[model samples]
Target: MGKDTDIDLMLRFGQGDETAFRSLYMTYRKKIINYCYRFFFDLGTAEELSQEVFMRVYKAGSRYRPEAEFSTWLFKIATHLCLNELRKKRYKNWFVSLDSEEGSVANQLADPSPEILAVMEGRERKKKITSAIRALPGKQRAAVLLREYHGFSYKEIAFQLGQSESSVKALIFRGRDHLKQTLCGEFGEGL
Candidate 1:
């Protein structure tokens, strides 16, 4: 089963197959959540937003059209929700934790080993990358994430973003340039 199967399932759900909706939900639940997580860097918010996406899908079932792939449509909804949330909150700062279960403060204190230092360094790099991405203008961030992280083609991203393909290309190019400048400044190396 592939994209066509998704369309069939959506059409079936539209026609009142509860099981079809369930199947679609189960299939996309984690993907949507992770996508939202990347946008907000918060698992709880991501889960909540993903629920809203499915809710919209459920409510719009009857009107759902196969104008695009189901995943593309689903992501469009997710993107809008995420962008709206950003505007509503206007979070000025976000702190990403550098600790993991294995790298707890107590453990680090007990053994300030080279391996632990490496792990900490890796987390720092990730933090810098995440911060750089978050600093991008919303549309550019969305375009970059959709193209680089989500493996979306320019056409698909344009469709999801309601922009022209050339515009999507420009957004991604500018986004990448911004990220490169920011990350290179921090790391003193190419991204």
Candidate 2:
């Protein structure tokens, strides 16, 4: 009769309703997995982390509260895990893969276009943007990804990141400015 809300579903799960857990997992599984993928650009690790995220959610069952939205709580858990993993690599080596469909830069630039150089330049631009994003510090990158890629509001990002809205705004602002500088140079058009 009524559409099921995430809060309602979570509450049901907390009550030991297996169907509710299944529904909740199905609803957010792909989203959290993809979100995690953006961090490592690796499907296997992302899948592992996403599975852990759900495990944390399941463990938090009886303690779950609706103080924040379900998405927000879930992402908070995911962000914590991702940040922890990133911190471990802060000074260590990290590399990007070159899978054509999976974000490997070489694969991204490998395809030829009917327009030849023009299409190549367009892909180059995309590659440049990706490089700039990679250059961003993890928190700034996370802020930008949450706000831009995931359609999160500044307020939502702040809530998810445990920061003030002003802080989230500043992070996004700085991150965008860095990207603009990297892509746009002194003039409007990219060099």
Worst 10 residues of 1 by lDDT: 94-103
User: Which pairs of residues collide in model 2?
Assistant: 98-104
| Per-residue lDDT of candidate 1, residues 1-191 (tens digit) | 59899999999999999999999999999889988888877788898999999999999988999999999999999999988888875565554443444446636486677887788768777877877787887789889988887899999999999999999999999999998998787688846
Model 1 quality (TM-score): 0.88
Q: Which stretches of candidate 2 lie over 4 Å from their true place?
A: 1-4, 90-126, 185-191
**Largest lDDT belongs to which candidate?**
1
